[model samples]
Structure formats: C-alpha cells, structure tokens
Target: MDTTALEFSLPNAAAEPDPFSIADLSPEIRFAVLFFQRDHYCTNCREQVQAVADRVDAFRARGAEPVSVVPEPLDRVEQWQAEYDLPYPLLADEDAAVGDAYDQPVRFGLLGSVSDFLGRMPQIVVLDRSGGEGDPEVVYTYSSNSTFDRPSIDELLATLDDLAADGETTSTDG
Candidate 1:
C-alpha cells in the first residue's frame, strides 16, 4: 500500500481528530509505529499489545513512538489501555476507516459465509519521520492474513535499529 497517501482522523483520549501525520504531533516524533488490532477483547491482541508495551523503551531509544489503532469506541480504547497498562496512545477507529485505510482483511475467503462477519485482522506499520516535515514516510508495512500472524518483538526492534542506522534520529525538543 502507498502509506504516504494514507490519512486518518482517529481520536485519542486527550485529543479529537488526531492525525497519524507526525508533523501534527508535537516534539516532532522521529518515527510512528502504528499497530492495528482486531479488538481489545481478543487475548492475542492483548498479548501483542503487552509485547509492544514491553519494548516501548527500545522503540523510544531509536526515536520511534508506538501507537495502537483499534476498531473500538473511545471509551473502550481508554478502558483497554488502562486495563492492559499499555504504554502508548491507542486511537479509536470506531468506523474502521483507518482499518480500511491500512487494508485490513475483512473476511476469510472460504468462510465468507459466516453470518455478519467482518475481518479485523491485525497489522503493523512503521513510518520514518526523519524525512523532515510533511507527511511521514512508511518504511515498513506488515499486514496479517490471520489472527496469529504478527511480527515478533525482536523483528520490530531490529527494524527500528535498521531505521536508526539509516539515519533516523529521535528528537528531544518540543
């Protein structure tokens, strides 16, 4: 997918209509790692988020910030964050527009007949913001076809290292 063309208006607890664009977030974050999850109630989703929470320091060390996007209401987003002790912001994609933007799978091909079913498969996006202003550039995009498909924490950390080696720098200024 052409991530540079991506745009979303999800809500954070403290802000309404928070854009994924790094330029809009203060302190000029160097990178934005967006994690798209199926639902907050899923055990695997909780585990995946916990993994991200555990390695958040590693991401921050590499000048990247991790944000989670879920197809839940703002209340649920906030509740889930507190319940799981998530270390980063979780955006409320209630309409699933962001999910559609990231091309999340909606149905299993053979199981398409499942009643009222909608695929909320998970995925991760790593955006390089060191490009300096304007829209952030997507350096990595991982979309999972199944519930169990997710990049390991090690793999994500290594990707952050690679981006840093490629000259992505974290910002300490507001």
Candidate 2:
C-alpha cells in the first residue's frame, strides 16, 4: 500500500469516545506512532503494546503519541486495555479496515486464515504530522510476518528522535 496515500479512522479505546480520525490527529500531534496489532491472543502483540506503554512518557517527550490499533470490537478492546492497564489509546479497528488501509500483513493457509480472520499481523508506523495538513507523512514503517517479530524499543525511540531532529532543522532553515 502507498503510505503517502492512506488515511485512517478507528474508534478510540476511551469510554464513550468518538472516532479518532488521522485527520483529527494530524493537526495536533507532532507524530503518531500507530501500532497495528493482532488480537490479544497473540502474546507477542500484547508484549509489544506493553513495551510501548512502558515508555509512553519518553514518546510524549519526543512529541509523539503512541497508540495501539487492534482488530477487535470496542467492548473487547476496552476489556483488554483495562486488563493490561495500558496507558495509551487502543483504537478498535474491528473490521480491520484501518489494518487493510495500512496493508498490515495477514497469514495464509487454513490456520493462518483463521488467525487472519481474528485480526491482522503486527506492524508499526510512525507518522510525522509536525508539518501538519494533508495525509501526515510516513516517516517510518515496519511490518512483520511472524507474531514474534517486532522492533526494539531503542530502535523506535531512535527513529522518533531522528525525525524530531530533522523537523527542527527544517523549521529553522525556513
């Protein structure tokens, strides 16, 4: 999928919340690090979400809001969030529409297809909306075929830091 072309709208994990659209986030958020995750059944996915939750402050310091996107219903999504004590938003992409837009991988074969039906494969996308307007630029993107695959926290932080630095330089040059 074309990262530049995709836009998204998923229900935020918050109670009685409205749909969180990428357009709505773009203007205010310097960066939105979206974690496209499979269902809670995937232990690695759960761990990955927790890892991001652990460093929520660090990401906030860098002007990035890390939000997890799960392919589950709102009720289940809320249950998972409360159960895990996740600090960040876990948007419900129930139909996997957002997942499909981002081209998050899906397993093949019968069992794989069952997994696919349950949810999407794991991936991470960092959108630089500091520029603001239009579709926020895709500063970074990573997809994994296996459940165990995920980028280290250090790597994610470095990418955000690098993007922040680049933004600073660009703004100052103007």
| Cα TM-score of candidate 1 | 0.80
Under the 3 Å rule for N, CA and C atoms, how many clashes does model 2 have?
0
* TM-scores for all predictions: 0.80, 0.83
Candidate 1 global CA lDDT score: 0.70
Candidate 2 TM-score, true structure as reference: 0.83
List, residue by residue over 54-160, the lDDT tens digit for candidate 2. 89898888878888888888887887778777777789888877887776777775575466644357888787776545667776778776777787888888888
Native-to-model Cα distance after best TM-score fit, residue 147 in candidate 2, in Å: 1.0
Query: What is the per-residue lDDT of model 1 for residues 1-174, given as tens digits with 9 covering 90 to 100?
Result: 354736556777433334444456556567788888887676778788888888888878777888888888888888876777776777888877777776666565546323113566777877776666567777777777677888788888887787778644332110
In candidate 1, the residue pairs with backbone N, CA or C atoms under 3 Å apart (3 or more residues apart, or in different chains) clash, namely: 106-119
Q: What is the lDDT of candidate 2?
A: 0.74
Badly placed stretches (over 4 Å) of model 1 are 1-5, 14-21, 109-118, 167-174
Top of the candidates by TM-score: 2
Measured with C-alpha atoms, the lDDT of residue 64 in candidate 1 is: 80
